[model samples]
Target chain A: MRRAKFKAAAVAFIASATLASATLASAPAQAEIASGAVLANTCFSCHGTDGKSAGDMPTIAGKSEDFITRKLKAFKSGELEATIMNRIAKGFTDEEIAALAKFFSRR
Target chain B: MTELTRRGFNKGLGATTALGALSLSGIAPATAAGKAQVVVVGGGFGGATAAKYIKRFDPKIGVTLVEPSKRFVTCPFSNTVIGGLNTIDYITHGYDALKGLGVEVVHDSAAAVDGAKKQVRLAGGGSIGFDRCIVAPGVDFRWEAIEGLDAGTAARIPHAWKAGAQTLLLRKQLEAMADGGVFVISPPVNPFRCPPGPGERISLVASYFKTAKPRSKIIVLDPKEKFSKEGLFKEGWAALYPGMIEYRNLAEDGLVRRVDPASRTLYTDFGEETGDVVNFIPAQKAGKIAQVSGLADKTEWCPIHPRSFESTLQPGVHVIGDASIAAPMPKSAFTASTQAKVCAEAVVNLLRGAAPGAPKFINVCYSLVGENYGISVAMVYGYRDGRIVKIEGSGGLSPSGATPEFRRKEADYTRGWYESISRDIWG
Candidate 1:
């Protein structure tokens, strides 16, 4: 039992140490996606996490970046006939919409 | 369980190995300089989502979630359970997925938080230390605010606010009530959880009464002059159950003063009234732990930094959900979960010695006028001048008069919202 405990503790320590180092190395890459992730995160509450819809709401994940950008802009400009998307689209800036489009496209 | 196992293992190991492991793992005695430790209190929409997102944001961070229940019954869509439109099992969620994300799920309630020591004292006896704490302890009723209404008396008169046994109790009460009987709901004043909750409850109960007991009537004694989606609800009420529901405003003596649960009587300023079934939602404040820990101010809500949601009173602690004084953001599940994601990112950035990004929030509340008929109000918010303010001309209520098809579509989206949000938070 004592040997097992020692082994387990050692494994946990090594695992955590490796994870800490991995996080440090990936910091810059994570920052690149951070803004898009933050903006696209809100849409996950109704749209599923990562822009995949679990229900009637259309899934935005895996769509083309151009498709998303165009649809959101159309919704924002009131050219797209929608129920609630038009209202939500009106809140985002062009930059934010682009970030969201990029984030979901890459999902 | 991970922490507990580590603690037990450390006790049996030699001093050198234990010390080496502790330093390497960054477990306990101090923040130690390696992995970040975050202790989240409460496991509802706010804390659970924060816990999950924090790990998602940075898997290296150690997250310990403290909650009392093994499974959580959600407040949203709970009205459907009372109205017999859905089952309790459908609305309840488990924390297994959060555990699967490598979060330490501690099934213990938090008794108090020691801000100075940076530790949370648990009711189960041991204390858990943290680099930062996220408190999402929703709301608790001011039991003293109403006479003859305490936790014990609340058993007879169900508030059903927290959505568990009380939900089932209210449903059974409605089932037991005779035909043509009066169903009374007394909604409290502003800044309460789910401002539109009372209206939705009234609408759903009326839906049940309209079908099960057609002659049964509902009496809504609202303290507020006007309510959320008032015109939509009024229009729907007229179209569906006209004259079946009567609403009394504050000027008409709608505020409830005291309740006699034994007799099912409520005493308003005007006179006394009795109901076969009574749901007296009393005045509320921050959750019990937040109130007792000096996190809430005189207004009974925690003040927070609009950008990071860090409690103004407690520097290293973040407060989210209904307990937070996030005006222009009504207390709803969507807002709480969204706030959780924002607070999670902020906590991660703060730990990494980086500034939190600016955040924008969205809330779309859909209430069922009937199972097929729904009305909604949506708002988008941005941080401005030390407050969360709604963007101008961005959000408004659903069109006043709509086709039946529109209402039905909104209702469909309501179910979709619940499923998607539930998955996002706990799935």
Candidate 2:
């Protein structure tokens, strides 16, 4: 009985999402907003969820967007001393850095 | 039968609802609403993180994580457990936190995946359907590759590869041995789980022997010529446990053709060596489910789309972690969790009929040369023209000439990483 309901729900969701995507596909701006959320998620592995640190790693959440962008750029440029951040910072583009910074700063 | 594409899906959206009627032929619970379902197989670093991130990305999507084990013992710090610096409990995690996150946790092994039918047949019986599926079964040992080593005989030799009981067994074996006894550690060939694992294990076990059993020695029969953090590990061994560790690379006749578990002996190409305790990590491939489900190809690993980790062979199915052929990105807890997030986001996007976003992945692996000594290798990966490649000038090993204090700080950070990553994924 439970299995049948799950199947029904899954089909409905795909149907709704299909209709929803018609709208999302037309709007490039909405794609960016969603993209930013996922790009910043990669950081949670080390930096903690939503950029909050649970241990010795520094808390990236609650920081200013400008602070994040500047620090990341410095790390990328090798202007800042880092253990692992320098390598990670180099992987992101200026735009991605901005998105990540914006994502974390809001938290 | 009708085909479905993003461009033409709108026309067939009506057929999707009619398909729901086809599903009503079977029994289904009333609570299952019109939420898209994602079934995640295996609850290790990959599956757990994928489940969490999928919900994080879209709470409306229903997620059911299928794992056989109730508790997850991380491979990351299992070396510390063997070294006596930590206990198994420190590295062990429960699924309660994941359960608290509104994920439907199913304690069952996945028996088969019917991709065309969009259903996962469980070993416990019954089937769960999914709009998308994520398989993160980690790695299973290739017992046939090594003579005298199979699941039944593993207890005597103890791979300790999967942690939990095996970890305790290996630790107990080491503890039972006398001070002057020899410990033999043999690492399998390339593309095994956790590239830095054996190196770290050798270092930690040496650290253990250095204190409690000063006369004890370690013999490493490595199949590969070199390993991750090779320079750092070699330097640390020379400085800390000089003359206590002997490393024999493949070219030096370190290949073990067979194991004599009854005698605790390893038969290498040159000669057979007996030890008080033997740790043999056998050659590995994607977990059994991957092969049975048709996710793995001739390589015995799943090939995935570079951008989304979706299986190239099976659409709507994403394979991540040790099960996938993601070279340049070594199989570690960090990479598994990182891949999980990328896959989760991709799955969410696909379910929503939106294209997956451009992905960025990072991997940081820290190995303890001793209790207060640590070294790390890190990389930030990006999608290139057709594959995942290391971002140039982005990541590398720790400085070879670092001061003791720097090493100690890195060791501290190792603990911090374990805590934060655990919280992020299962917390």
Candidate 3:
């Protein structure tokens, strides 16, 4: 009985450590998206690269992550308001939304 | 059967509710930085603001914003679409604002969020890891509660509560209605998005009909006995639209029970209502994503840290905007923006390992009654003890029936605010 308990504890610790290491590995990729210059291609159609809005488009350079996430969710859930953007936004997943927020916030 | 005290949630949330603080400890302390990656769901006023604010307060802390759309339409001024004051195009904005801010702006929906794993999984396939996460995904239409009402019924019945296409559809329906026909508008129970929204929408639509379709009448059915800006709306209804606008304050007995799309009829608990057009705004809860994430309680809303807006369900996960149980604060764009700022400040403070001081909440809701008549309310709030407490009487109605000039000035301020706030969130 003692041996079984010890084996289970060791297995749990190893699994936890593996999960922790895996989580740590992907985080830097997110950092790279924020600090690096990878997302410019996706932008500029409406916002213009410098955060200067085009026509009635909003300037989003210095916004908070929470603000951005709420708006996007509105687009997803069919709450809030949108037109064509809702159709376009239909393509992004939650992870991509996070990546976009991180990249733009860094810029 | 352990009666789920919070009827809708699992046994875990029940305990967490009894001890909201206990479960929060299992998660990383809000803003803790061990290079912790935080995931934020949604991209509206709250989600957008949280993402931008998190990065602003702490540069090293990694943040991800999961939103389904690249662009968002402004609900604040959407009524203008119905009034012919503006087009839907005028209110739309892409995620360019967030992308420019260096945010990872995803363009898809979040399928689920496993609070235990601190992961937000997308509907597509993969999932992302997070030390902390935030959800501001707005509300969903409660299609089940209303008989004979589903998305199809809404298409013909026209519930523009969600904005976007629904707003346009309601507007189009209004435009198509007979000149002398009856148009019925229903306001959902309170604590819904934009408390004064239904009132504002009715007034704006009435204003349009006054000039365009003079013979038409607008009947408003409300579930609540009272509403935001009631005194002002009543005063204006008497002076301006008079008999053209009628209101029925329906209590529980008067709840809308069924909808008939073909005849344009709404059968309420009180009686059957018929109109050339029917607009039903149903009772709502948090976004489906929030519910799936297990952040929602019996209220179908996420409970959060009053100051940080962080979700109590999962550590590092925060909720803001219409989905959160932020009382004394209406679900307005202005209120969302204010809450977003506080959440941003709290997230920043937490990330820096600095204890959050007393955080303040601010909000101002402005509504345009007639062409030039405008009314507004503003207030500031702070954390008291463990709960949120509002500073009373700090604001009031627009001086209780002020002059036309005063109302006009209020209108101007209203316009200015829309410009500034849109910039504050998207910029």
Candidate 4:
């Protein structure tokens, strides 16, 4: 039953994404959104997909954009206490951090 | 192809309605308009993750993962198996999950790569064409590095470095040894796969002896003056397994020049030493396939473009994992998987005739000092000028002088990372 739900959800997501792509095809300007999912997949190696936490790691999904941005910047700046986040955050540029913040906030 | 775009044009309808139709129909949209073929060799962390991410990025791009083995045994947690903390089955994974993501998982060895023809020849006698080839064949030992240490000798004196039969062999050797027996470990020089792996194994073995064979002692004859997480590992050895582990650096004549499996003895410049069980991890180079395929040059490791992981020696071919010389980024499983993501994106972008994007790679390696004590090192890297550069103040070792509670927490995090990374790659 869980597998069935997951497949259904996957189909729904692909369908919506396909629709979004189609809607933006006429306006190429709007199609320039960064591929957040591509980069975010790396984070799933520790944090769960879409910033969901599977273990002790904090869940970033649905967090306020400003909160996510602040935390990432702090980690990048070495102003935050973290086991691995500071290192991982340093890999991202300011633009990427903002894009990820926006992506996760929507999740 | 037109049908896909036509379906996309139905965006005039509400997203909920489109999703409802998609769910009821059980049809996944085409990933892209153009169909590109990506052939990946070696279905380990790098290859498997690359195939999955490529399909995720653009399902229209066909991905064929060529790995001889049906199931992959990971090196990350295999040390626990040697320590009897976990079973071999716990670290083994199949490619079914990757297949589910629309990747063609071919259980055949990539015998050779034809750069000009853009074809990968299989060991079974056939060639598969590819628009781009990604090779992630992990490291192979330089058999001649140590005298009298080859395949047959390695069976008796196990390396246990590749994480399958050798791991079990080492475990058996340990189990058969008598109490108070000496277990000698010969760690290879730098530029080897998993810099901290040997130290972690020693810690776990010491942990096992702490309970099972209290009188047994472990002696590490290391070639290098210092090793990854040297301070943390030494501290843990002192705190947890006092008087059980002894490390001899190169300055102290620790380098093993030769080994005699018949006598179970190691010969160093200083003198000779014998042990009941000996683990002689050898110096490493790129995998045999990479060498034969011309991906690796005289360096015995593949050089690649830092931004894309494309082979600098071979165009239209990308090399990653332990086989690739990603300097400043040690050859580690975490780095391999991270490189795979960036390589996947680069392959897709190249297929679309766009320049590859600038990439950021991160590596995190966790070492278990005891069953409940862990230490880690992490780094964030980016391509600058013409090489991979570590971002300053980005990562460091697990803090020193922490309480037991802190170490225990890091241990939990270690297990969590293992589970998460394994699932991300294969689950």
Predicted candidate 1 versus true structure: per-residue lDDT over B318-359, tens digit per residue: 899999999889998889989999899877765654445556
Q: Of 3 and 4, which scores higher on lDDT?
A: 4
User: What interface RMSD does each of the candidate structures achieve?
Assistant: 11.0, 6.3, 15.6, 9.9
lDDT of 4 by residue, A1-107 (tens): 97587456544443433334444333211121135665566677666556775665677889997898899999888899676677678777665676677778888
Candidates in order: C-alpha RMSD to true structure: 11.3, 8.5, 15.0, 10.1
**Cα-based lDDT for every prediction:** 0.83, 0.82, 0.66, 0.81
Instruction: Give candidate 4's error at residue B182 in angstroms.
Output: 0.9
What TM-score fits each model? 0.89, 0.89, 0.74, 0.86
Candidate 3 deviant stretches above 4 angstroms: A1-107, B1-35, B251-254
- Give the Å error, residue B420, model 2: 0.6
Using Cα atoms, each model's DockQ against the true complex is 0.22, 0.25, 0.02, 0.19
**Using DockQ as the measure, which candidate wins?**
2
Ranking by lDDT: 1, 2, 4, 3
**Residue lDDT tens for model 3, B220-301:** 8777888998988778777778789878886544467787889988887768879887888888888898888788888888
The digit string of per-residue lDDT tens for model 4 on B53-105 reads: 88877787899999999999999999999999999999999999999989998
Off by over 4 Å in 4: A1-35, A76-79, A90-93, B1-34
In model 4, which residue pairs have backbone atoms overlapping below 3 Å?
none
Q: Supply candidate 1's per-residue lDDT for B59.
A: 87
Tens digit per residue, CA lDDT, model 2, B81-124: 99999999999998998888889999999998877688899999
Report, to 2 decimal places, the DockQ of model 4: 0.19
- What are the per-model numbers of colliding residue pairs? 0, 6, 79, 0
